[model samples]
Target: MSSDDNAAHMKETKEGLHSDHHVDILHAEVLASSDLMNDAFDGENHEHSQGLWQSVKSHPWACLWAFIMCFTIVMESFDMFLNGNFVALPAFQRRYGVETADGKWEIETKWQSSLFQAGQCGAFVGVFLAGPVTNRLGYRWTTILALVMMNATIFISFFANSLTLLVIGQAFEGVPWGFFIANAPAYASEIVPLALRGACTATLQMSWSIGSIIVAAATYGYNKRDDEWSWRVPLALQWIFPTPLMILIFIAPESPWWLLRRGKKAQALRSIERLGSNSNAEGTQQTLAMMERTVEIEKKLGGEPSLLDLFKGVDRRRTIITCLMYASQNFAGNLIANQATYFFEQAGMTSEFAFQLNLINSCLQFVANALSWPLTAWFGRRTIYLWGTATNITLLMILGICASIPQTNSTNYAQACLGVIISFVFAGTLGPISYTIIAETSSVRLRALSTGVGRAAYYVAEIPMIYLASWMLNPTGGNIAGKCGYVWGGTAVVCFVSAYFFLPELKHRSYREADILFNRKVPARKFKSTVIDVRENE
Candidate 1:
């Protein structure tokens, strides 16, 4: 045959094979969907048709496991909020402060800020370390190891006589902080049914607020004490949450997705059985097939999972969105809100009242976080993020205006009060919801690594903002007062814009569905409405 004729024939043959493959994939999808629907509608076990409450009722054990697992974040919350509370304590200041000419004692502003950021710096290290560790050890063991290390570091801080030692202890405590933050949401997302994913994943934020509230109350109870014991007592209390977490974590099942990736198909199926409400074997089998097929598709698209793979192709966009989502938590005035105790005290509220106010703010935040579960389940991540960002920006700008006014004692109190309320809104809405977005955005194979990298961005973003917060609010620093709000207000504007443009809604999307959507490069706005056939698309 002529060379041209042979080439044309070969091209036609390739097209015919491609067309046949497409037809076969579509045929398979139709068959799988038919089976899935039949299983979902089967007699008494129609989990797919059930609401969240019904699902919970049907799978009480699985729901309980998810709840217990989320409680681990309370320890993370305590560690995160402890520095903010302690930095505002007069007794803590007196213990660490240098005596001045007027017989007053003051902790150095640089140390005050750096001590808080020091833990975050350690968190940065832990965040990177958590990815590989979780990949190898799975979530349960990684968490146990992290909890042990966290307890050890907290004890070191509780005994330390020097600020340097205390800072080191805080830094080490952060290592576990990184581990928990990286793994907790990933774990929750994996174990919970898709119907409950929003509410369940949001427990990460809710638990953090619960932890913050406990510490705030602890600090309030100790604030009036005139010795080192005041701070020491609260620091010691860090051990409370982890003891139960370590015990409970042992009983929790490994993520089925993780097991499936590691080729433990039987264990993976058993995990699905334990965690899923779908009572029929057919339903579980369908889910397992979806998972396996999705993983296969991901393998084709991205080779094998690695740290470097997070930054390639569609994953690069996912990484950026995830990182920015985490960064948005801090940038959306989280640092300023976190330092509410210090800011209130600086504005002339008595130390006890400041702590009391902080306690109230924590309560408000806890309520807000609880509210977020329903809100997130109803509205999804992007809407909450955009709305929350706008709310925080307006509140911060108003606070800046209030702070910029000439200081009247009443106005100072007013600014502090307003700032606390604004912070509560931000915490309930943006702060915890960001974790959900990160968890949902990542590919299953790279979830730990993506979440770790995203969380590491959170700490990295906090570095400058922490110092800036110290300067703006500290008496010895720029003491920008409410003007710090202006800076964070501007940041919130940036966050709002980025989230509106880049953050896609993944409210009801399964991991495989999310993969297909990202693979197709769907516009952010279209995610909610776009229908994808995961089996056929591959």
Candidate 2:
């Protein structure tokens, strides 16, 4: 075919795959050009030989872009932590809390639930909205838009007069949180080479912990002030992440996969060049062909490549695994760990000491998140996830057992210490690795939609759990305090059991290998032993 004819034909194939999801394996241009197909397969093998260090060296710009995008997660985490910790601030209580029969000011169980879950509710909306918006504007503009929207939403939060206003502000703030949560890891997964994929995507969780740590320290520092500034300062700080991040995202390269789908192959090649810091012209074309090949495989697997496709064919299993990976995090006791400051005070510690312990707890969480990277590398995703959940279950049962003893400072301290430890354990395991699973499992065409759906499941499960948590922790409510560990422990048992039986190990597999395994319907337990046939002769 002439060059012009070939360009037109390639565009037609991409449009078929993207618009209709009906590209035929035999007729598609991927097979039409045997040399292109062979080069694409060769690129996949070269990518496999490259380790994490080499991948980083090969794609430094990709790593940097992923870092900046993940850094935007700091905004979400800071706001999320601030929402859960609000009641821990005496000044915040004075501003929003009601006077109690015992002469202490406290936020209501109902109001507390509303405040704490408000961001999540908005996040749920944001996750769904991102799909259509990203389809229209692509990932880069969607991120920039979300960051700008955050400034408008946080304004409502910083100047709120009533508890009702505060809830509304937080809900609005959550829309951007949802945007980042659903899209950042998806972006990271698409832009990086296979060797850098896990680390790049898992960086989302590390950024989350960094945000939590900063908020914890800030809330602790500002808690002593009796003025409204105590709460206002934290709310105001939300602006810092978006403005700089918005500017950075404005200049970042768009996801080449999205670019390719839109049939902007030239732009896609340029993007790969921008992302591939060390690749020569030939290397960049190989990467592009490799991406094109993966998209073609997905095209053959499912037509339409929409959210509904997430529940059909091989994708159904993938969607289930992705959703469970995320939902398990909530059910497996991090809820209590997240609300450590409130849980500590409810367990009978003084407010000042609770704040101190909360700071320390968040710091430990940051350290744990960092430690999980090496663990993910050595033990694989499934091992760390199952073992972490197992360890959390054991610790939670012991914590519940401790909560049962007559309420003493030693017992309360023990409970506080255990909450800290549980947070550390969870941060090290499920927290970061969940992103890796989401990145690896979903079909390439449906990655953003799948990520949004999976994370939406998290918000869905968490909404009811938040109400339950507020009821359990509120003095006017159940006031079960640390004993909630028993409740979460039961849920952790469910996570551990389900994970052992269902979650697959995708440790060193390239995206194509993952697709082949999932398409062949390999059992989760046998994933590690399944050998893929990579020969192009077929």
Candidate 3:
């Protein structure tokens, strides 16, 4: 046969295979060759070969914008820590105290549990709404609106005199907290260079630790007070970060990816130009082209963006993996870290020491998150996630055994210390890594929707987990104290198993490359070795 005839035959065969859900070996080889040819011929010449430092030097403004936007995650973390800390406060307890058998003041278990649960519920609402809001308003405005809502809710909580009002205020706060959580990582991923995307998105986890540190310090300082002002002061302090952010956010650029998805090509170009430093122009253009091509391919495959699209065909896997990844954050025994102060106190540590331990844990988490930049650069996301989950399971099991022992100040202290170590591991690994995975795994057109759904899964996981943690620890409920670790230890085992089987290594896969891999139905184990010509793979 002539070469031209062979080419025509292959082309005809490829078209037939495209309509099928499965790809045969011959079809796969042809598609792979086509992609290779495209890469060889495509005019886009910029390389993603730059290291993190080189990328930062090339796009300083863009990196800074990503860092600043990621800082919003701190507020969400701060709210969670603030509620955790306050529940242990004598002053806070007295303000909403109910009589106990000993005739002493104590916050009811229901109120204690509902405070954080309310926030999670609100977060669920925000995650549900984030897709529409971000799609319509773009990243910058969605963030600004979240800040505005957060500030309003904080002020409401600052003035509330009753538990119901306070819980309501916290729920309101969760709305924007959810919005920021859903959108900020997506925004950072879109604006930064591919080499720095993991590091930048990981900043959300770092900011979360920073916020926890701040709340711990603030709560530690004020928990000693005897007035309503003790709790109210911390509630009011929520204004500190967002007030500055709201004003400064106007100066930041909208996500170029979002703009392009909306068909605003000129504005998307301007956004990319503004975000990238002058030296990064070529890379910016390459990135823009990559994004454009990914969107075009997705549109051809799935038509317009819809929430339902997340569950269809290849995206179904994306959505499930992303959701499971986010769920790993909660299921990896974070409950131990989240309620550390309470657990420490229950185990017989003084309130002061418990708060101090919480503060110390936050500091360690901050350091761990900082260290994760290099670690993430060095290792794949799946490796870190599995390792972290395994470590957490071991630590939680040991802590549970220690708690099951007879109560001694020394044993309690040891439990508190162990909790600190768990915090460090969780923050360093699953917390930061999951955000990057969720962002990387989703289709470009459904990035916002996928992230929102993933975050909703996170909150959904939290709903049952939070209630269980509360029931186990609350004096009026299960009051399991150190033994609570057993429950989470079991959960961590499940998380580890899921990650081993499902989480693919997305180490440096470009957005389009990921889509191609998923479309090809590549096994998770093969992702590291399966090289696709991303140039025309989509």
Candidate 4:
């Protein structure tokens, strides 16, 4: 055929194939050099026909991976908040007298009371150890070790008698909670489709809210029972939820990136194939390229991140911003959720009403979490954060105002209920959104470390507030609501300043793209000026 005729025929042929078939030529080109498509299709240039979700399910191994991941996250969330709804158990025991000395409250010396705080102390240790351990041991082993430690700790905690042993057990249990905190986000990010990564990343946080609801319901059911099993029942039930899931985690596929880092290319290909990929070839290619970039950047950065990197470098602002965000999250005062029963009692609500309030908060949290999924996507991260902060600030102020007014027999309780509703709304939105940002903000090399730092800050801020401030807020004949409001108002100021100055707008940015945006040598407030992306370059 003539050269002109052949060229015309080829153009028509390409257009015809494009119209007749769903596959993009560019996608095929991107997959050409990769191992993911090998043997799964027919010819040298054949396209993989399965839909994204279809591919996800068809790969038994990938489905198992996502399931195991989701399960671990769900259980961790459940475990993390076990103490949230049961402050009343110890408080009730203290109020009603549980083996106390003359004129001195001895509940502080009990295993049950100590268990409440020990888990958080353990989490602090876990957070400190996670980065080094994960880097050295690999994600799978880190996860496995954490699960083993957590399960063992849970079982041992049930058998403890003295407050000391309970604290030891709870602290030891923090090891795994730390492991989950450090690794789950990285693990989930590596496993799921980039398109769905945000949703899946938020999955654990959603499950956390759900788990809180579950624990609240259980606490409500067992609140008044005098049996030793009443507390044991709730504690022991942790095994029922996590043990089988631990076994599943053991068998789930190792992180594809982790495997790739070890030069296990064949295994990595098999891993992603089973795990889902974006249907567009460009996105998959982009992911693979980003993974390559992660390794390159890690090498160039030289050695693990130093403490100064979190404080003085281009990355320093990110660290500060994450810390501030985390602090705000904890400072919003979750004590109300955990110790709501006590807070209510101090505020003149009865024990029965306190439990009912706890149940209501848990339910509202679940609904609010469901609402956040759409809201976060519809409004950018920045907008949701601002909205949540404003909402929380307004709620806290109103609660403070209400508390200052004095609740006499003639006062309406509806305003008090309104304050409780506001607390629930604040948690549902900012609580999860802050977590989502922490996991996504930094580069892969620094993600776990940053997460560890942020969690440490979160717990440090959290425990003290819950234990001390909440304690003070409940002072006899004090403005309990106003005190709580003042604490949250301080948090709101931090949230507003941090959002405006330090935090970047990261919506729709890829991991590598985020790395570039954050690595730029500019103040965080000026990040938009230095932000770089391929689209902008083009």
For model 1, how does the per-residue alpha-carbon lDDT over 448-484 read when each residue is reduced to its tens digit?
A: 9999999888888888888888888876778687788
**Superior candidate under TM-score, 1 versus 3:** 3
Model 4 CA lDDT for position 9? 58
Q: What does the lDDT read for residue 227 in candidate 1?
A: 93
RMSD values, in order shown: 8.0, 4.2, 7.3, 7.8
Off by over 4 Å in 4: 1-81, 90-115, 277-286, 303-312, 409-412, 473-482, 522-538
Models 1 onward score TM values of 0.89, 0.93, 0.90, 0.79
Which regions in candidate 2 have their CA more than 4 angstroms from the true location? Answer: 1-27, 536-538
lDDT of 3 by residue, 476-528 (tens): 78878888888889999999998898889988787767878999999998999
Alpha carbon lDDT of each predicted model: 0.79, 0.83, 0.81, 0.60
Q: Output the worst ten-in-a-row residue range by lDDT, candidate 2.
A: 18-27
Better of 2 and 4 by lDDT: 2
Superior candidate under lDDT, 1 versus 3: 3
Backbone atom clashes (below 3 Å) for every candidate: 0, 0, 0, 1
Where does model 3 exceed 4 Å of error?
A: 1-47, 99-104, 280-283
Better of 2 and 3 by TM-score: 2
